[model samples]
Target chain A: MEIQYILEIIGTVVFAMSGALAASERDQEQDWFGAAFIGFVTAIGGGSLRDIMLGSYPLVWIQDVTLLYIIIGAVVLSGVFYKWLLKLRRTFLLFDTMGISIFTIVGMEKALSLGASPEIAAIMGMFSAVMGGVIRDILTNEVPVLFRQEVYASACLVGAAFYLGLDYLEVERNTNFISSVLLIACIRLIAVKYNLSLPKFNRQQRQP
Target chain B: MEIQYILEIIGTVVFAMSGALAASERDQEQDWFGAAFIGFVTAIGGGSLRDIMLGSYPLVWIQDVTLLYIIIGAVVLSGVFYKWLLKLRRTFLLFDTMGISIFTIVGMEKALSLGASPEIAAIMGMFSAVMGGVIRDILTNEVPVLFRQEVYASACLVGAAFYLGLDYLEVERNTNFISSVLLIACIRLIAVKYNLSLPKFNRQQRQP
Candidate 1:
């Protein structure tokens, strides 16, 4: 439990930094408040949506004020390290990938604990990993990268299915958790490294 | 209670139509499925967010399957009347205005019932009224019209405040409901007719 909590904290911090970086890089006119707001949303949006869908109360952040301060600190630190962070784009992507992996497992576990079906849990898990970026893209007035990017949500989904399958076989909890997270992270990294992407929907060729 | 239910149904239908129309008018390549999906999100996004925030269980649409069919019907009808709907833009705007007003009061009352504070309730009301459109704008890859448009959200806020004040003053519930909804509708219609809007935040003049 303690390890899970620490992992969640790390994921939240990384997500916050990514969000701040995204906002800062998007528009020259964006102010500190704008960056911070976007960062906060990007970090919390996915989990909040998952909790809401699962009918959980006193959202994770609301339950722990420490998480709020952590997010604030993360956002501010991102702002302070703005140029340095931008220069370390590869490192940032690594952390973002790790964050998504952690969030996916966390969300899937939470939904399962809430008695949600495996299918719903799997979908919610992917949503937990990706919806923040999706909301961030929406806020930034761009098509969600989830819809266009290489092997993001699908990676989460595949990892979730693996976890569920292992759990059904009575695998040890921590082993299942770590293995699933690693699987997602590896898939995302490989996809990005290889410049792999799903085929796009051919809008023009589709029957109208 | 029956009257409120009827009003909510009306609001849902109008919101669904607006969403479908928005999707259809935005991109020529948008297919029927795309338009319906966008419409469903736009119609349910605000209310679902509000319910989640308030820790309300069994989301409105989830509990009432009838609402699902209603939204689908509304979306399909909008597609069928696509050309006519565009031509009757003014009429559509009026319905949208009416939809916002009804959603505001309904959201505020629900928040109050869920034991939220007046301030949260008021803000949630505004959110319920405008968030669907905000989400729609986001999905459509536009800056939320809420941030740029006329006195739309502000009108909802004002009307929510009026409803709360009336409730405090022990006004009859039905009277308070009708009056607040009308107040919001009027304010919105007037704002649109006169092309009035709040002042924009001057990003350049501020300190970095």
Candidate 2:
């Protein structure tokens, strides 16, 4: 329970920071309201959607109102440290990878507990990890990171798959959680370090 | 129930057309798969989100699989008549307005039936009518209409308010639905005709 609590807080803050950074990058032309709203959406958007799809009631945030405050704090923190964060792009990206790695396990566990198939659970994990950025990019007027050549969804899927595999093998919960998170984070870090990406989709216009 | 079914079908077609047109306009470089997926998201995105938030199960589409076929049909129809639809921008916009109008009533009714307050019901109505376009714009990499100075959410709010008013007055259900839908459609048409728009949020860079 303590570890679960720690993971939740870490995931929440990191996702909030990622959202705030994303908003600052895109919404310099807008005000604090825009920035804060965008950050809020990015942090909770994916999990909220996943919860809804799974027919969970009152929403997770509604159950624990402090998450909203955490997101608000992240928005202000990003605003205050805008210059520093921009300089630490790689650092934040690492944090983002870690955050999403946590999200994948949390999301998958929630889905499985809800009686969803492992396949659906994996998709939900991916959704929970990436949907925030998807919504944020849409709000800021850009193609989502997942839709691009980034090894984004693939990382989440790999992590979710590993977690499911471990669960099937009767691995202890905390051990399974930590292993899956590390694997996802490691994969993501390697992908970024190598400038690795998925092949571009055959489309009408190549991404500039 | 018969009338509700008719409205659902009509709303589906209009939304599908709106989504298809939106995709063709913005994602032309993408292929049929892109367009179809975008259209599908736009048509069902809002109501689906609304349903999820309300803790409704199976989702509307899962409960009635026919909706998927209709969306597919709409995608194909839009693709075939891409040129013709392009030329009839006003007509398509009208259809979109109608789609949102119907969506407003349907969403509000659902929320109210779930024992939501009238105020919350109004918001659900607005969300159901507009979130589809919001998601579509995000996927296609554009700012949502609501975020900009569009009369979009306002029109839905007005329709939702009218619906609640009629309900409070104990008006017949069919009459209330019809009247609210007409009002929303008319408001949207007039807004477009007159180039009416909401004031931009006081921002660092106003939208040009």
Candidate 3:
């Protein structure tokens, strides 16, 4: 199996868990259907948008029922360990960071393979890393974390650029892949630990 | 020109206006870029989702850059008349209603032409009519109007079903088209005027 394919599978599982955890955290109790729906969407939202934007057909979940099953299993596990999982905030962060890093590389590669310009592929990578969380935040009626303070999508974009640069330099594929993922994860983790954030737009404050 | 084609252009314009209006209504005064971005997304979001799901290639906006220009034009107009537009809530509602009705039929027809099943086509129609607004609301950090009190997407779904049934019975194409659009519009207007809504899922209320 291709290394990218393995990363994608890992990303899918972590995304599913992240989504389920988010659903469970909402004030309103989600029934099985609601939890499962959110989980499925959160796992697939970014990649589906990337595919759709790229005009790639047969959505990943639609083409592979196994992914659907995996999402369901993740949701079930979340429900079973709801309390324990909620207490594991650090664990949730770890999985989410891992998910984004893996998805960024996978999405960038997919876009490149489909002949998208490097710039466009880098954007696709960022979209894949963060759009799922954005959609999840939207569904839960929260301002998307993407728009909030802290290095999030920026981390993905920087990692994607690094990966592209390394590839351009003809680095070994495995070394490039592993380093790119680690770069994103480390950037995100360090940013969060240090409370670092990108500057907000300095729009003049006007009374509503 | 086909009547549906005409209606679609009209829908596009109105949807763009609706999106710009929504962005303007947010508490923060949006800069031109912010307003234009929201307008563009609200104009194309539903149709794009439907096309993507159906594996339709070359997204409408991408295939015809004219739509992008139109959305930008609408955004500029909205900015010019922001205060005046805000005061004309009924005008906004009228345009929004018209936009959804037209988009519903256009999306359903597009899906059917692409060989989607009637059930799936109906869903695509609802997505077309309401997903833009849903996305707009999400971006603005509100629970979507579709989930709030009032028949929104439901009205679109009913009209889509009515159109399909009429087609099944060999009704004249123009007649079916006009009637379906009118049906959705009337249902939506009446439901909003009378403050009607679908029943909420009566999940047991649990203390958070």
Candidate 4:
């Protein structure tokens, strides 16, 4: 399998797991449905938004049925293995970090290929990497994690910058993609492990 | 004030009232916040979605602060006048129909101005006119009214077609816009009065 395809599958599984975890936490009768919905949104929402924004024809998932089946399968499996997932939260986080890293790079590449400027491409990458989680949070009535002071979007931005740098250096495409993904995954994993986050806005009055 | 702008304001108010009503039915402690969230979604979600899809800068309400104030005010007023709103449901429906009419034409015009093809422009118009209500429904945990074999999206599509037909005939802009709005409002009101609806899809059959 192509490396990008492999990365996408990993991302899909991680996203589905996060959704299942969230649904289980809700502790409601609609747990299964909610988990499935969240999982579907987490797996496809970002790409769907990107396609709409870019005016891409026949949206990505619409063109590929495998994505739909994968989302469904992952959600069901995760729900059934809920206890196992609870014990492996750290493992899930690692996968999630890796997923977001690969997704950010893929988003940037797609946007650039569609002729967006670098700034817009970077923004698109961040949106694609985080929008699913944002939508999932909103649906679950939680303030989206993105709204909190976090390194989430910043991580995507830094990764995008690194990718752009490699491009400017005329790096080979496959090597550049791999390097960018690894850099983002490493940064994200370390940040999570250390509980590193962006500084919150200072709301106190300041003297000149 | 432009008639379109006037209708848009009316639409926002009517949609806000409907949202508040739905939220109130939930019997929750955060009913006020729920109402406000729904009201805001009903009032502005479609336009926000449209702007995002079109890559427009400074999303409509984000540019116009007054829209936020209006929705907030509406939510508060609705909460205070819940009994009165029950009595005015029919009047609210009329306002909503008018709002949808104006929005359908406005959305089509915006799409055309943005250089979208006619078919895409028509679809955008329909989407912009009905998507707010769809989002409101989803958030409230109700199935969207649009997909229920309703004449909702059809009304917008008809109005868009009317506008395009008049434009093709070289009619005056204001005349075309007004005629299209009136046509849509009349059709929608008639549909509501008679409980008219499109044919529902059978699970065993494909949509024609």
Candidate 5:
């Protein structure tokens, strides 16, 4: 199997787990349907949007029925292991980072294939990486983490920039792809570990 | 010129005003950028999603560009006449209902043209009718109106069904289209005027 295909599967599984975890962590009383729906949305929403915007028909999930099965399996596992998984916050973070990194690369490649300029490709990549989490947040009635002080979308942007920069330099396709993914995952993980975030746009207080 | 084209333009302008009204209603001091962005999102979000899902490339906004100017103009007008517009709540309601109704027919027709089944067409119609408000609500940090107590999405569904049934019965295309739009808009207007809504899934009764 192609490396891209392998990474895509891994990304889907990890993303699905993160989505289910978000639900379970918030309220353990959440039912199976809610958990499954959120997980499914997190796993596929981003890529589906990119495909739709790029005019790729039938959607990835429709074309590859395996993603549905995988999401269901992950949701079930997350539910069964919620007790033990509750202690694995670091594991979830690692997987979330991995998932977004893969998503960024895949989205950039898809956009380029669709004849988008490098700038537009980067944007599509970031959208493809972050939109799923945004949707999950909205469905669960929370302000999207994307809008909050997180190094999330920025990480995807940097990865996309790296990919485009490398491609412009005539670098090997596989090398550029792997490097970009690693850069994004590492940046996201490090930012979280160090409590780094973008500056907020809060209005200044006036002196009394 | 096709009636559909005229209705689409009217829908865009009315929806844009609603979005601007949402912004201006919240923070009186909100700048132009926020109003413009929200209006743009409201004006095109649903159709863009339906188009993307149906593999319509370049998106409607990109295809026409007129939608952007119209939305921006509406937002500015809403801002300038904020006080006057505020008292025209009924007017806003009428236009919003009309906008979503037209959107329902347009989305259903687009899906059918893309070779989707009637069931899927109905679904797309509802999606296109409500997804804009859903997006606006999420961006503004509120739970979606569709998910709350309103007969909104149900109205769209019934109208889509009506359109499909009429077409199946060999009704004229224009008749089927006009009837669907009027039915959805009327259902929505009546529901709001009569204070009708879906039963809430509230876990507990409100304390007196």
Candidate 6:
């Protein structure tokens, strides 16, 4: 398989795992509906938002039935194998990070192909990479991960910069994609491992 | 004040009351954030969705600061007067019906002004009338009122038809608007009173 196809599959699996993990943490039964909703959001929420913003017709998911089947299958399998997966949080995190890395690069590439400026493409990429988790958090009535003091969007921004830099240097497509994905994944994994986060917004106290 | 402006204010007030009622029912504290979110959705969700679908830029809320202030004020006031309002559910329902009626008419008029076909305009009107409640429900993690087996969208459909009928008869603009709003409100109130609903969708069970 082409490296792009391989990356897509890896991203899909990671996002699916993240969705399943989130649903499991909600203390709700692993029902088909809940699992499917979570999985779908994790898989396509960002892409859908990007499509809407870009005025892309038919939407990415609507154009591809394979994605629908993948989402359904992933949610069902995750629900069925919930016990075993929960024991492998580290594995899940690795998958999730890989998914985020690939999605960010792919999103940026798509935006650039659509004639968007580099800055717009970078923002779209980050939005597409993180919007799924944000939507998931909102749906679950939790503050969105994007609003948290984490290296989420920042990682995507850095990865997009790397991708652009490699493109400017006339690197091969496969090499550029791989390097950018690896760079993002490494940054995300390291940040999570060390509990690193961006500074919180300071709230000014009011006198009573 | 102009009749249209008066109707808009009435709609805003009633929508805010509906939001406050829902929040109170959930036993959520009447905090500023929760109340503002609810009120904002109730007042502008439909219009915002309509604008997005129509490709209107800047969004309605982002353009109108007064609407935001009104929602904030309404939420705070409702919270402070919770007990008194709870005892007036019937009155609130009446106002809510009126709000939906006016909103439906306004949405239809806007869609028609934008030169959409009658079918699309009618659909937009229905969506614009109910979308706020749907967003509010989703945010609160409740099944949307639209998903309920009810004549909710039907009311808007009928109102749109009424407006078109008035237009065909060459009625005055003011008369057409008022009649259409009243038609929707009356139909909705009667439907609610009689526990009326449309037939449930039951296309097919999953196929293996």
Best by DockQ: 2
Candidate 5 C-alpha error for residue B24, in Å: 10
Please state the error at residue B27 of candidate 1 in Å.
15
Give the runs in model 6 whose Cα sits over 4 Å from its true position: A26-30, A147-149, A198-208, B1-20, B26-134, B137-208
Model 5 agreement with the true structure over B1-208: per-residue lDDT tens digits: 3778989989998888887777455543344545555677788889888887776678877556566677878887887787788789878888889988999999999899989999999999988888988888887787787877379999999999999999999999998899999999899989988988777668687699
RMSD for all candidates, in order, please. Answer: 7.2, 7.0, 7.2, 10.5, 7.0, 9.2
Relative to the unseen true structure, what is the C-alpha lDDT of residue A150 in candidate 6, on a scale of 0 to 100? 82
**Full-model lDDT for every candidate:** 0.86, 0.82, 0.83, 0.77, 0.82, 0.76
Tens-digit lDDT string for candidate 4 (B7-84): 777777777777777755455445578788888888887777766666666887899898889889888998898878
Candidate 1 displacement at residue B148 in angstroms: 5.0
Where model 5 places Cα greater than 4 Å from the true spot, the runs are: A202-208, B1-44, B50-55, B61-134, B143-208
User: What TM-score, computed on C-alpha atoms, does each candidate reach?
Assistant: 0.60, 0.60, 0.60, 0.57, 0.61, 0.59
- Clashing residue pairs in candidate 4 are none
Q: Between which residue pairs do clashes occur in model 1?
A: none
How displaced is residue A136 in candidate 5, in Å?
2.3
State residue B121's C-alpha deviation in candidate 5, in Å: 15
Q: Score the docking of each candidate (DockQ).
A: 0.15, 0.19, 0.15, 0.05, 0.12, 0.06
The TM-score that candidate 3 achieves is: 0.60
DockQ of 5: 0.12
Which candidate order results from sorting by lDDT in descending order? 1, 3, 5, 2, 4, 6
Give the total clashing residue pairs for model 6: 0
lDDT of 3 by residue, A38-154 (tens): 788899999998988988878888999998988899889988988998889887888889999999988999889887767668868988888898898888877777656357788
Could you say which candidate leads in TM-score? 5
Worst 10 residues of 2 chain B by lDDT: B198-207
lDDT of 4: 0.77
Residue by residue across A1-208, what tens digits does model 1's lDDT show?
Answer: 9999999999999988887777455544454545665677899889989988887887776556677678889987887777788789899889999999999999999999999999999999999999998988887777787877869999999999999999999999999999999999999999999998777656476576
Summarize candidate 3's per-residue lDDT along B41-91 as a digit string, tens digits: 789989988887887877777566667677778888877777787789778
- Give the C-alpha miss distance for residue A150 in model 6, angstroms: 1.8
lDDT of 2 by residue, B10-113 (tens): 88887877777775676366578877888889889999888878777777888998999999999899889988998888788888888999999999999888
